[model samples]
Target: MLEEIFREYDIRGIYERDLNETSVKAIGLNLGREMLKRGAKNVSVGYDARLSAEDIFGWLVSGLNAAGIDVFDIGLLPTPVGYFSVFNDKFDANIMITGSHNPKEYNGFKITIFKDSYFGADLQKLKDEAVSTIKAKTQIKDDFRAIKFDIASEYKKFIIYQFAHLKNMKLKIVMDCANGAVGAVLPEICKSLNLDAEILYPNPDGNFPNHHPDPSEEKNLKDIKEALKGEFEIGFGFDGDGDRIAVLTKNRNIKGDELAYLYSLVMKNPRVLGEVKCSQNMYDEIDKNGGKSFMGKTGHSNIKKAMKELNIDMAAEVSGHIFFKERYFGFDDALYAMFRVLELVQKGINLDAELEKLPKVFSTDEIKVETSESKKFKIIEALKLELAKGVKELPEVKEIIDIDGVRVRFEDGWALVRASNTTPVIVTRFEAKSEELVKKLQSIFMNLLDSIKKGM
Candidate 1:
């Protein structure tokens, strides 16, 4: 019944194999029913530049039609634009077909309901309904009407109008789109802003022939950085869906915490929120600036919901999901983030200079420890048991925060080990005051992990 692809957040799997015509159609029907049951009148849909996205869309349309939901087709746009549809056209729900950072072989859907993310139990409910209906041989209408929607232009105009002041700033910016859906909307926005922008792999190539569509990895920025030989001021990179962003200065890529710190300085009395993965500097800077800060679990949906619950105006995750309720709608829009940086530059701020002021710390980019799907959680559980039992035995770990998973805060800095909610791996990152401390922490954690694995 295609339950394998239905994850805690969204539906994702390989093309034609895990997400074929039958399974996808059934999944769409389930989403449509969920929309109807939740009292949504229509759903807006968009997709990335994947070869199979075109055909898979047809199956999705069929399911929406069967559920009697009107379809507004905004073809080949970013997920953020799909998110905009719910607000732009007053639609009840939005769905984006994208594999996100995954390779060309993968494709999936990210869903939103009434502006909030549709995930967790909500996702499970859809899977259950899809499977049960398949078992019962349920009946649904086979027809759906999709009208071409010009959301890209409208979204572009909105962004340009909002940041019209940054136009003609004469600040050169290099962008790497990774041949994803941003190809349709990003360049237009940049043009409107009068940004001296140079784009790499801007065309919508589903194959991603150059590299995978993930900017979080520093290696992925190789070409873009090399292109920045002279003083380009900054560089911007986008993921497949264009909701995640990687901000770069001339010297180094700025993590999400760095962005929050800069933004907090500009935003008056800003209430900032950073996910557990965010650097400690973000929180410290916000506190120093007389602004309040809070920490939450990582995930775009989780952060969005947290923003609403805690009345936070802005939020950021290490993966570069930036949500702004400060002045506009609360959602992660990478295109918008690019312009905001331009405005910051216009205000006589240098991104790298600001970051250099912070105390230096040693950190590692996210290290993914691959494990089997069935064994990932078991490993975490066993490790948790060891930590709890030998709290005094292991003097290295001073604190254990299992808010999302386990984030151990130490005196020097901190280390985190969390089972990825979206992937079958233990995602880890460590930050310390010195390089030696970072290595010490990483070794300590890895040794514990190896020990636990060997039943030592």
Candidate 2:
């Protein structure tokens, strides 16, 4: 078992290379034991459309059963549906086997113990236990001992009923499923709602022949954007496991923070949570609109934990992970977010018009600098120290927010440099009042980061 697979948020790595039968079974066994310690009796397991999903599922189940925990196989489904199974009170714990917008050869597990995300320190503990005690030649069982469950159908019905109001709504929209797990249920839900929608790449293909299953990249939304050029009023694109979303109009691709701003328009005094990478405009706009905005760390697990602690109604990441607690479960679901966007449209709220009202600020998309996992956090620490000492080349510092990494607030804008919890990369973003300022801030920050990297 490679320790690198035990990430801050979840366990992920290349199949066979790091997540083969022996390693995956060991992970399942250890994870099952931890679940039992927490008083979890049974876990609902689901997988995405990854080619190795079935093989991994079998191995994982064998290990879980060896740990004396019951397993409910929810079959192929989106990550959100797996979350819904837990929130629906059908299982004590849940594990979704998905690559989650990663390359097809990669796969991983996203775990939920009851409603809480099983991550961070707990994940580290699991790693320690696996490394110290678990054996390399763990026995594999032929029988999976898993009971088949149709949670996907249940989740689809629940969604359809929840958004029954959108039935036969006169709105034209297009969806790009990216050939991931969302294809399993979204089309059926759309049909049941009688939505005038066109769905592209609805078939679940682990190969992802259409485009990469990530909608956050501008290139992936090309087909959907091209469809929007016709009579389609809106476009929605989804990532592999159907958790993240990209909302696009004829003019703009609405990001997660921007989506939160739009969702808050109809909400009364909404309590919204945003991550460090969110634009300054998002925070200021929400605050100015009678809503309370709070910044938290950048992972879904971090955001969800913060939401529970802060009693927040909504939370969003700029990369399209939006969570809601106002009227539904506070888990990130792109399908659920799609309905909410439809609700906004149903209320006659023009999506593009509402966005245009926000203060125009130039912002750069997340810029990632490749680095080794061991050096990423060290670089972040060095950058923070340098900023604290006040580098002359940098702009005047208003404040340094170290909630996650380092978000340096400037007089005109902000610059952020943080280590990606999942990947071996340093993530950076900059926002300013003008394009020129944005470029300048990015240049200075990158230069400082380069110096820090060189010194290390």
Model 1: number of backbone collisions? 0
Best by TM-score: 2
Q: Which lDDT tens digits does candidate 2 get at residues 297-414?
A: 9998988899999999999999999999998899999999999999999999998998888888999999999999999999988887887788897777899999999999998999
Give the local distance difference test score of model 1.
Answer: 0.84
Per-candidate Cα lDDT values, in order, are 0.84, 0.92
**TM-score for candidate 1:** 0.96
TM-score of each: 0.96, 0.98
Best by lDDT: 2
In candidate 2, the residue pairs with backbone N, CA or C atoms under 3 Å apart (3 or more residues apart, or in different chains) clash, namely none
User: Model 2 Cα displacement at 441 (Å)?
Assistant: 0.8
For model 1, residues 128-225, the per-residue Cα lDDT tens digits are 88888778876655565798888888888888889888878787788999998898887787777777889888898898888888998878888778
